[model samples]
Target: MVLDTQIKAQLQQYLTMLEGDLVLKISAGEDKTSRDMVELVTELEKMSPRITVEHVQLERTPSFSVNKVGEDSGVVFAGLPLGHEFTSLVLALLQVSGRAPKVDEAVIKRIQAIQEPLHFETFVSLTCHNCPDVVQALNIMAVLNPNITHTMVEGGTFQDEVKAKDIMAVPTVFLNNENFAGGRMEIEDILQKLGSKSDGTEFANVEPFDVLVVGGGPAGASAAIYTARKGIRTGIVAERFGGQVNDTLSIENIIGTKVTEGPKFVASLEGHVADYDIEVMKSQRVAHISRKELVEVELENGAVLKSKAVILSTGARYRQLGVPGEEAFKNKGVAYCPHCDGPIFKGKNVAVVGGGNSGVEAAIDLAGIVNHVTLLQRGNELKADRVLQERLRSLPNVTVLTNALTQEITGTDKVNGLTYVDRVSGQEHHIELEGVFVQIGLLPNTEFLRGTIDVNAHGEIIVDKHGATSMPGVFAAGDCTDTVYKQIVISMGSGATAALGAFDYLIRHTAPTQELVGV
Candidate 1:
């Protein structure tokens, strides 16, 4: 029989009243409440006795034992048992009943086998909620394996510890006495590190380098070439061969190249750097960076590297719309890269926010494919080049709305429409569309270098004419740095300059003096 809505509502109310810091006890074969149950029932009986309370029947089985008190003694209730509140409930229940949930046998065995307690402390802040997932995963591991004692320390509370660990961002997990995971981490990755069974079969010794380039973008690749050609032992560390340029649709101005797609041009640049004897470590992230006599870098997988100088070439990410429903409908209907998701919305209406070069280019590109393009601008005019502005104005399918702001994205499951406010008229209107592309600009990924170097108010790393920052033995190049002209050609030129500056610093500091014996 189906339960009536009124009865369900009443049952839910009864369950809500039952939840509190109280111990519940149960006994068998009695219609009336037992003494322990009566105490709990008496407390909650005033709230709602009609909710139903009865003695549970014990099963007659050989496996069951009387020594285990809670054969049928515990409170069963509704509502999702989750979050911090649920953890408190579980602890409370265990205190009264003297029984905990059964853990995995293999995991328990592994915990018992561990000789030492693995102390893991992860620093996190409410501003960085993304860290909680990592913390929760580690907590689960701690539960399964008692050998691991994990603690989540709020970064703001421990200001001294944060300064000591150089905690720039959240999700920084420290394993044992070493900094383990920095950013987002996978479960298997942490597990492998804890359970490494290697016999040094995949190990290799690397020599110390004069300078190490940490990215292979236009700036980083160029830095490696210039440093290597100058007779310095240079190395390049890149998660990808070409960095963000590989995702660009087209590149028009790279000095020699008039018109080239991002991937092909980046491939050529990679080849140019690969011709030298410099070591290239692709698909790797620098997990830890420390300075002693020589700067030391630790890879994500525990490989150690030493260098005299280091260059940060990590670029930036596309700025998000930050409007409601933008993140909810991210891949389904909302997108940042027009070239990546534009084709899917062909013959469909789409809205492009931001009137900059990327936004104007996206509008021009979408006008050809989409049924109609609404170009919304927060200001009176577009901020792109004159040529691009002229091209956008000439498109018949593109409608440029000046002094317009996207107030909110209206969609239940995916993107269906958008609400925009007219800045000039103070009128709000909803546009029925299938997709929205946000190209507001870019945000520097210099979060990793927060206290390491000087950054401008806009969060871009501050550098001099030669791409040298205020920090000694450290340099920054590409979009990460505060260069007014953010073009491919300019990045390459700055990268070359930074490389030369690094070379000079290395020679002056490390090279030995010559007595001029020939003279």
Candidate 2:
């Protein structure tokens, strides 16, 4: 059964409180996933008396159906509910049980205002941690509004449909059969795109700011707080507030605390930044930037903003494996975030790509939970610290493969094996495993600024110790810059330094604002 004792206990607690008879009618076929689905629901039935799962044998192969006891709910899952979409399945069950997902009243109202019926078929894999946020948001919207229907289509189970749609990524949303969004979108982004208020503004109508922080992560938040405290008209425009921090699962390195999760930490960050009078603009990505009198920042949504000084904190994202089956089995067995997805592969064999510190650390972490780990390194030796390698060597279940190049991720519905080539032997080998953790490296999000500002060879923005960029009025911070460390505390420190640097530049270069001369 996929549901472990811990998850079963958790489901028991939730389903025990279930108000109504939550009947899950599951139809499975001849495929292996179909059998897996049957096993999963059979285990769920044993969790709580309120949860009654019925197994309907399907004549066809690989196709399945799951729905509540009602006819008009218009909510269902056509595949197995595992991985990150597991969140969607659980939340949807809770919603059907008369419990609502946590959402703001303002957002609920905005969702209710949608005039036309919108069906959001969000294609997702079970391992995608970011997919849950969008799926949960849309599910809550469906619960709030009768005009909306949201379905989580597990990409692995439904390959024919995924191929038909030409979907290359998880979290790709099809709004009413049209391509709506591409990647991780905030709740605000979903609302605005569907039918909420306009997210764009004319450059002339927009108010000027003394400083504008382009990102809303720890760095951007810290920068905006520091700049606004100086009594200057400071603003921030971010694609999302938390940025890469939200993707992080466990955070123990922040000096003050022993441990904290990503979501709660980001919520605290938003609350902390709310105390100041900062013009926070969430759910906006910068399209381009140019210096015309002031730094002109144009958004993908067609809005243009002007600021005297700017701090770049766009942050970095995890690099992909670019191998076959890597995209298709992303959440199934091929994963990127070990912290976020390591637990999903408990008691299962897995492999890790790269020999860096992150890869070795991930192997060490996963070894405690999973049955075994096979680490593949392209280099002759481990790039991680000697201590880390020693610790990894201490683990009996962990195996290290040096000078290996990952060739393909092999699996049908769920990832069960990986093929890699030995660089020295010039021979290919296959390892049977459930998961692949890719920890090669990170690429900064600074390609938009080709040469507007100086950047390192790795595309990271070049900034001084004070967080000042090569340009006079511009500064940079966080993972997007050439900072040695890419942690939260370091990014926050750099952000504050950038704000202070921008403030100093403004004081020396720009004229002071005229005070009111009225009686």
Candidate 3:
């Protein structure tokens, strides 16, 4: 029953690509965890002859090992492999069969360059959809490097380890017995944390830039393209290129485009940025920024770089409800991303905060997976488009509450309920649920400025129509700024404006060459 007809068909197709036989040793038990795993692999065995499924009872050993060829090369799944973790199970099966790994070349090169061994242990549960992202990132890293050994343990069955570690969340990763990360993390972040430096030497002593952009989202991409077109020295320092855009599911309000996914739009942004001369420092974070005659930026890796003018387009992050248990239960039934963690809540009740398009869309999406969805909005009515509202109402499993303010996310270790107050009715209500998804709004990513630039009360950088900051020769744009509408196209337009403003300032004060002819 774990593997539906469609999933069984897909597994049959995938298993045929296996180069070697895979043994799945599942524990014989009536427990849900053990039975769920058994049902999954038994279905696979019926479809693919290459997959060997065995049933055994192991009181001391793990519940199951998917490449049961031994501890030398195997992954353990102590719980059912449902949700998005199903993909991880499939990939691990393919990998154990000597399949080529799908990892970034740069990452593989770093892993290949490692002198010391890296041991990674990731704890996960069957219901944690985001666990696969971390597990796969480390799994592929281990696959690329022989010295790297990785293990994925299902927290549900390993109750002793979970209790001993005081683990209340999923996707808890540890490197060398030290905490690495607990939730969704990028491979680059993992590499940097492991002290595996990028391919290039440190950025210290590097040549200064005429204009430096601090983020690599759409706003930063646009600013870089505009600055590069002006034939000026431009560079961008970013932890990631796509930013929050990568976490999005649908992007429909991009002006010319009717619709596109986050990854596609991000790829297009990268492709467009590649058309110009820009110094892109990926996986680098701006630790500090100071402005004297020149704007000096310090990176977390102790690298320093100077710029004549800087654009503050760092963008924003999803705002938390700031209620009790919101932080305590993060990744422990409290999730922000529906696309990344929705499947984990299948057949379980959950709630969504906000009446905006994102929140409503998330509710509608979750209604298809979870048993039920309760959407809370602080406003009198939904702020989403009429079509989105209509589609949301069309779903039977969704309940919308207007003018409801979330009071707290409640649970002992994981979220089990959500409390909210109705502003109009002056009454409080609580919904029993396993997960709460907050899509209320965004908080600008201008904290790194540390009061160096003028920011609004909401911590957003104040920018004029042309993206000029309070400081001369400096500019700001995108979600980091005080823009009325934080759309992708608007951010791009603001970035171009900031670049033009910078160009105008450079020509008038810094003295420009023929590059200033257009202005």
Clashing pairs in 2: 83-126, 84-126, 127-331
**TM-score of structure candidate 3:** 0.74
**Lowest summed-lDDT stretch of 10 residues in model 3?**
68-77
Cα lDDT over the full model 1: 0.65
| Global lDDT of each candidate | 0.65, 0.79, 0.79
Query: Clash number for model 2?
Result: 3
Candidate 2 residue 299 C-alpha distance from true site, Å: 1.0
In candidate 3, list every pair of residues with a backbone clash.
none
Q: Number of the top candidate by TM-score?
A: 3
Q: What is the TM-score of each candidate against the true structure?
A: 0.59, 0.71, 0.74
lDDT of 1 by residue, 37-131 (tens): 34433433344432233343322100111111323222221111122223323332333234333333433354445566677776665333244
Name the TM-score of candidate 2: 0.71
